[model samples]
Target: MKITLLTVGKTEDAYLKDGIEKYVKRLKHYTKLELIDMPELKNTKALTQEQQKSKEAELIMKKVQPLDFLVLLDEKGAELTSTQFAAYIDKRQIGSTSHIIFVVGGPYGFDASVYQRANDKLSLSRMTFSHQMVRLFFVEQLYRAYTILKGEPYHHS
Candidate 1:
């Protein structure tokens, strides 16, 4: 299955960018992966948080296709262990899923429409992290999940 990670704004820190790139390179051998960083909304000084989310939702939806399985990386979503997340990825592959889009919404989180369209939601942690930080964390977890699936030494219980 192809996995697409769609997030808002660019990852600025050199360390974070390097870390994410490292895992993404390793992931190339495992599956098709795409990283889409939608440009941050410009001139938002006048827009309300809800309005920002609404505009961000439009961009998020545009990347998603009708057949793609949308998974929102939401704080309130189901939390899974590394091994469990590996199984989740395995299950998707076995189920013949062609495309799975995992979205990291804007700072205020997803709008009602984005939530409505999601097929599933997953929480990386109960604690909140900056959206930029989330990008690195999610990619690393995804890489770990693959290694777990292959019984590699990269992950230990």
Candidate 2:
């Protein structure tokens, strides 16, 4: 199964961009992983938080295909251990999910439509992190999960 990570806006910080790139390269050894940066909405200074999310949601939905399983990275979603996350990926593979698309929403979070379209939601932590930072964190965790699945020393029990 292919794994795709969808995020809004670019990673402006050079350090964060470098870190995300490192993990993306490592993840290529395990699965077909793709990271897509959805363009930020223009003229957002005038739009409300809800309006911004709605506009972002439109771009997010466009990237999804009919067979893709949508998973939103949300604060209120399920929290799992590293091993559990690996098991989760195993389950998806067993179920023959074509593409597992994990989305990190914009600054104000996801719109109602985007939430409704999601098949599942996962939380990295209860505390909030910047959307750009989350991109790095998620990619690293995804790599760690694969290592755990392979019984490698990259992850410890």
Candidate 3:
């Protein structure tokens, strides 16, 4: 199964970008992992929060394929341990999922329309993290999940 992380905006910080890239490289060794960055909405100061989210959702939805299993990284979502997350990934690969897409929405979060399109929701932690930081965290978690699955020494109890 191919794993894709779909996020809005570019990683402007050099450190964060480098860190995420490192995890992405590691993930490629275990899975066909890729990052799809949606362009951030420009000149949105005049738009209401809902309008901004609507526009962002439109951009996000366009990137998704019909067969892709969409998973949103939402605050009000299920939280899984590293082992459980590894198991989940394993199940998807074994079940032959065509594509597994995880989306980190814009500042105000996803619109109702985008929520409707999601196949599942996952939360990394109850505490909030910046959008850019969340990207790095999720990618690292994904790399860890793969290492755990492979029984590698990268992850330990």
Instruction: Please report the candidate that would top TM-score against the real structure.
Output: 1
Q: Summarize candidate 3's per-residue lDDT along 61-91 as a digit string, tens digits.
A: 8989898989999998899999999998998
Give the Å shift of residue 155 in candidate 3: 1.0
RMSD values for the candidates in order, in angstroms, are: 0.7, 0.8, 0.9
Residue 116 lDDT, candidate 2, scale 0-100: 94
**Among these predicted structures, which one has the highest lDDT?**
1
| Candidate 2 lDDT by residue in tens digits, 96-157 | 79899999999898999999999999999999999889999999999999999888999977
- Order the candidates by TM-score, highest first: 1, 2, 3
Give the poorly placed runs of model 3, Cα more than 4 Å off: none
The alpha-carbon deviation from the true structure for residue 130 of candidate 1, after best TM-score superposition, in angstroms, is 1.3
TM-score of candidate 2 versus the correct structure, residues matched by position:
0.97
After aligning candidate 1 to the native by TM-score, how far in Å is the CA of 126 from where it should be?
0.9
Better of 2 and 3 by TM-score: 2
Question: Judged by TM-score relative to the true structure, which candidate is superior, 1 or 3?
Answer: 1
Q: Model 3 Cα displacement at 108 (Å)?
A: 0.4
TM-score per prediction, in order, is: 0.98, 0.97, 0.96
